[model samples]
Target: MKSLRACVAALAIATLGVLASPAAPAQAYPSPGIECYTIIDSNGNPQIHCIAVGALQEIDWCKGCPWAISFKDDIVFPETFDIDVIQGVENLSLAAAAADPRVAARFHDAAIADFASAARGLGKQTASPGPVGVYDTAHRKFVADNQSWLAAAGQDLADGLALLQKSFGSRDSAALVKAATAEFDEAFKEISGKQVIGG
Candidate 1:
């Protein structure tokens, strides 16, 4: 019994040591199949970046400036391509999802989280209507470089999402799912054509 008690004491101390240890560092944005592209900032300083996204989320620039890009056929794109085809129907309307509180809550929370994350993932920026910040130069160059693709892709994504939202608002599950799937396919193809110019 004394030995057992001593063992317990040892275990407690071990546990305490583990608890006191520093936490693992936060993960940086991954770039498995990504490529870094550079652009000159307003101050003529070079800015390099890669896009990042989480599952079931839209693509956006990474939070911090990391310095590597290696593509493995999984290049990120700026569209709501991560929405599930069948499950995304819940986003149609709050009233429509009232019967399934779980679905409603899941989508609601996810929407909130995605919105916040997208804002952060867009990288640091000053008030757009006012004076520009450091990152603005890179952003401007990115916009100019991919002007045509951005316009086309942005319009297509907007139209597709609007159609999906409208179908949901009408409580048309069939249309909702159809629109989501179509948008998924189109976004895949549209984004695949995007390129990061090395400026």
Candidate 2:
């Protein structure tokens, strides 16, 4: 009986060790407060905002990371369509152009010119009327409009990815992983309207 009890105790100890073993650190999920900003409405009402939807919570890093974005209830763009697609297109175009200089040069030049014009306009002190009849006195309105456009551009990229994955039968793990990472990076760039890091 004592031997049997000893064996049971050893088994219990083994089980406890397994349970207490450290798990691999989870992938960093987009927790709230990581990034935040605010926006104003047409009526000049200020609203607090978060890019993700729910109250941010940390999850196991080993599991897939999910992000939630939230905004004013009456936001002009719905959450589903807020991602920018044009940015992705621009990035993809630039990358392609880099590989083939001649074909990409014209597009790159046009993009640069457009960006330059906007920047120059922003640098000016006088306020100008924007498309929505809003006065761009401080250039705040101009920046916001540009930001919205970039977000739409990202959405476009996401759509492209969905289509590509569907058509290509992304069954190969390696290829699928590559494609997913690209899409995610592109989407992040579009939403943030910034250069992707570690690409």
Q: Which ranges of candidate 1 are over 4 A from the true structure?
A: 1-32, 35-146, 169-171, 195-199
Relative to the unseen true structure, what is the C-alpha lDDT of residue 145 in candidate 1, on a scale of 0 to 100?
Answer: 23
lDDT of 1 at 48: 38
Model 2, span 54-109: residue lDDT tens: 12222222122221222223213322122222222343334232334554455544
* Candidate 1 local Cα displacement, residue 142, angstroms: 7.5
| Per-residue lDDT over 141-198 for candidate 1, one digit per residue giving the tens place of the 0 to 100 score | 2211233333343344334444544444366857664654455334323333342211
Runs off by more than 4 Å, candidate 2? 1-26, 29-33, 37-80, 83-178, 189-194
lDDT of each: 0.29, 0.29
